[model samples]
Target: MTDTSIPRADESLDDEATTPVAVDEEIEEETDVDAEEANGAGREKKSPADSELFRQSEIAADYVEGLLDILDYDGDIDELVSAGRPVVEVVGGRLQSLVGQRGATLEALQELTRLAVFRQTGTPSRLLLDVGGYRATRRKELAAVARNAVEKVKEYGEAVRLDPMSAFERKCVHDVVNAIAGVESESEGVEPNRRIVVRPVD
Candidate 1:
């Protein structure tokens, strides 16, 4: 009788420990599921915005491709979203003509692409277009010019009026001027004649 009772008590203790282990396993499984769900939710939140941008890019690319074909231009086009905006780049030989002087043609093409997107999606888009990396090269040039203007303004302690620049060029200058201390920049005049004035901040 004693031996049988001891065995029974041990079995009861085993059952108690086993029950807690099972509960712990179930809790761990639930925690894993919850984590996965949280990750899924995070992905879902970001994907829609990115997808819309990508869609805009695709539409812009198609429009550009059609233009290139009509123009008998040989080029490769790449579409992407960068800096919260859609961008299309065209690379090929003899593409400088597409970029035109100071990227005027490229700017026009970009506007047309944006209009195409708006027509399709009923939403206006801020799309950037580059041909043969013109914008990238121009940006570097503009950055140097901005620095030079800022230096001049700092040295003279007077407002310096720069030549009329495109809206893109003006923005680049404004950004650079804003970054430096003791100076600020503003756009003056209208489109095609709009320029940046760098001055010492009072």
Candidate 2:
């Protein structure tokens, strides 16, 4: 049977890091209101959408399971809804191949899993897939990269442009830069070549 229980291993990584504090408060209040509405509407039962999201997660988990089996990989898959999105995490050793270099393969697999969910649900899914905590680890590393760029910009009083990065990586850097004082970041160039330029605040 599929393990639908959320693992505590993933909870330590906060998604709120990307969101501004004020916006996070607003989102929390909205979430509270939504929860109240859901509870009242369902009389303690889950709403249809909540049930559908769980189904999507299940489908995603199964699809990933099949892939792992075909690849002869060993891992434990956990599915859960987090931050209003379905997430599937595969935790195990030797999963670096799934993560690929800089998560390129992981991104591809996520897209495929999302497609599988959409095929079953007839609706596009925003499912997130992580292999061996690669994304969580990468997020921490990217934060440091952002901070280093910020330091350079602050010291030289000139913009520091970083190498091209995927959208997810760029967002990680952007969040870190946004949180720090006296520095700002913006994306320039096109896909596969798009990059972030960190500069001192005006």
Question: What are the lDDT scores of the predictions, listed in order?
Answer: 0.69, 0.73
Query: What does candidate 1's lDDT look like per residue over 1-202, in tens digits?
Result: 1011111223333343333222111121211223334544443344677678778888888888888787898999898766555677889997888888887887777666766676566665766777897766786788899999989988889999999887677766676778899999887777678788999999
Error of 2 at 108 (Å): 0.8
For model 2, what is the alpha-carbon lDDT of residue 96? 90
Q: Least accurate stretch of 10 residues (summed lDDT) in model 2?
A: 21-30
TM-score versus the correct structure, for each prediction: 0.77, 0.75
C-alpha displacement of 93 in model 1, angstroms?
0.7
Model 2, runs deviating above 4 Å: 1-48
> Which residue pairs does candidate 2 place in steric collision?
none
Q: Kindly list the per-residue Cα lDDT of model 2 for residues 12-100, writing each as its tens digit.
A: 42444312221111122212224434544443354677677767888899989988887899999998665455678899988999989
